[model samples]
Target: MTNVLILGANGQIARQVIAQLKSSKAAMKLTLFLRNADRIKDIAPADSTIIDGDTTDTDALKKAMKGQDVVYANLAGSNIEAQAKDVVSVMDALRIKRLIWISTLGIYDEVPGKFGEWNNKTLGSYIQNYAAAAQVIEHSDLDYTLVRPAWLTNKDEIDYETTEKSEEFKGTEVSRKSVANFVVHLIQEPNLEVKHSVGVNKPNTDGDKPAWY
Candidate 1:
């Protein structure tokens, strides 16, 4: 079975990923990592292991990552780069090579026109920090897939499209459910693609900004 470790386990998208994984038929073992496992104890699948600790704490992260085949992070914040560095360091020490990292669109100025302007203007520091984190992962020796999701919403349905790093990002927003589905797909199909930064969004939603914004 593929042993998977999910960091920031209580996050909206991360929780959705767990829910989807629980219903899947893939032979897998899941470990949920969070600073406060109590927040997720009741929600996580009974078979999943829960680790309570900070991702920035190398010792804690290493312990949680031990023997894991894949690491998926749904982390955020201004110190994201620092947190990612810590994760990378521990994973490296443990010789864990597969990483699936969540990031955001507009990090590379991929969004065009008003949407790009608005995203950059609104989330300047967050975009910068996320970019730095992605860079850290990209330069690491681990086989990684960095997902850059557009503005997220709590929509109940899942419908999304993707664009590679070299392509211009399209659409304005995508549902968190869609992003979770994509992440679960990656866990199930380990070799689909690797070492690429992908942009995901809802098709035909191209606009100046997310509708909710």
Candidate 2:
């Protein structure tokens, strides 16, 4: 069985990712590392392995990260760099190279136009931390896919596009559901998503980065 370690399993993206994972091939095993076991238990797969602890606790995280084919980080906005660094270190020690990291668009000045300007202002502090975290992953030897999702929306739909990190991506926004589905695609395809900083957003969409969007 392919054992995969998922950090920050309690977050929204992680939650949606878990749902998609449930329908994946049975040869896969999802081990979720979360701080709150109670809530995680409530929604996680019945067959999934669960680890309750802090990511900063290197010993604990390393223990869970071992013997896994891939590790996906869905960490919160606060202290993202530290969490990502810690996860990367654990993966490094274990020699686990496949990484699926979730980052926001515009982190590397990839977001374009006036929308990019607003995205920075709206998510300035968090974007910097995520940008630094992306740099950390870039410099690592691991096979990584830095998914730069546009303004995350929690819609029930799954229609979205995967762009080539062009200037047009800065203004494009995607639904959380679509990103989750994309994660599942990456998980199944492996290196297909490797070494790429891809962007996800709704197609043919443009204008003032919708506040309600």
Candidate 3:
């Protein structure tokens, strides 16, 4: 069985990914790691394992990394950079490569036109924090895919497109479900997009800002 460990598994996108993976026929052994295990205990699959611990805790991370084939981190916080460093360090120590990280758009100032300016102004330090976190993953020797999604929505549909890191980001908004779907794709095809950062967005949704904004 392919062992998969999900950090911050209680997050919306991560929850969606868990549900999708469980519903599929893929032979994956899931380990859900989060700060509060109770929050996800009810929803976690019977075959999945749940561990409650802080991502920055090296001892906790090391325990969770054991025998995992892939690490999908859907984490967020003001201390995101530190969290990224900890994760990378633990993975390197265990020699577990293959990481799929969820990041946000505008981290690289890749958004174009008026929307780019608005994003920078609106997100401010959040973008910086995420950028620093992404940098941590990018610099690591691990085979990683950094998924930079556009402004997130709670929509249930999963329609999205992607852009390479060198290209300007597209559209203004994408659904959390779409981002989850992309993450599942990465998990299933581990070799795809290795060591690359991808920008995900909805087609024809490009504007000065997200529609809800």
- Model 3 Cα lDDT, one tens digit per residue, 12-100: 99999999998889999999999879999877999899999999889999999999999999999999999999999999999999999
What's the best-to-worst order under TM-score? 3, 1, 2
Tens-place lDDT digits, model 2, residues 1-213: 778888888989888988888876657888999897777887777888899988889999988987999888888767778888888898899999999999888777866788888888888788889889989998898999988888778789988887665445734567888899998888887878688888988776676786575
Best by TM-score: 3
lDDT score, candidate 2, position 142: 92
Candidate 2 achieves a global lDDT of 0.83
Better of 1 and 2 by TM-score: 1
Question: Hey, what RMSD does candidate 2 come out at?
Answer: 1.5
TM-score of each: 0.98, 0.94, 0.99
Candidate 1 lDDT by residue in tens digits, 5-114: 99999999999999999888998899999987899987788889999988878888888999999999999888999999998998899999989999999888889999
Q: Which rank order by lDDT, best down to worst? A: 3, 1, 2
Identify the leading candidate in terms of lDDT: 3
RMSD of 1: 0.8
Give candidate 3 misplaced runs (Cα > 4 Å): none
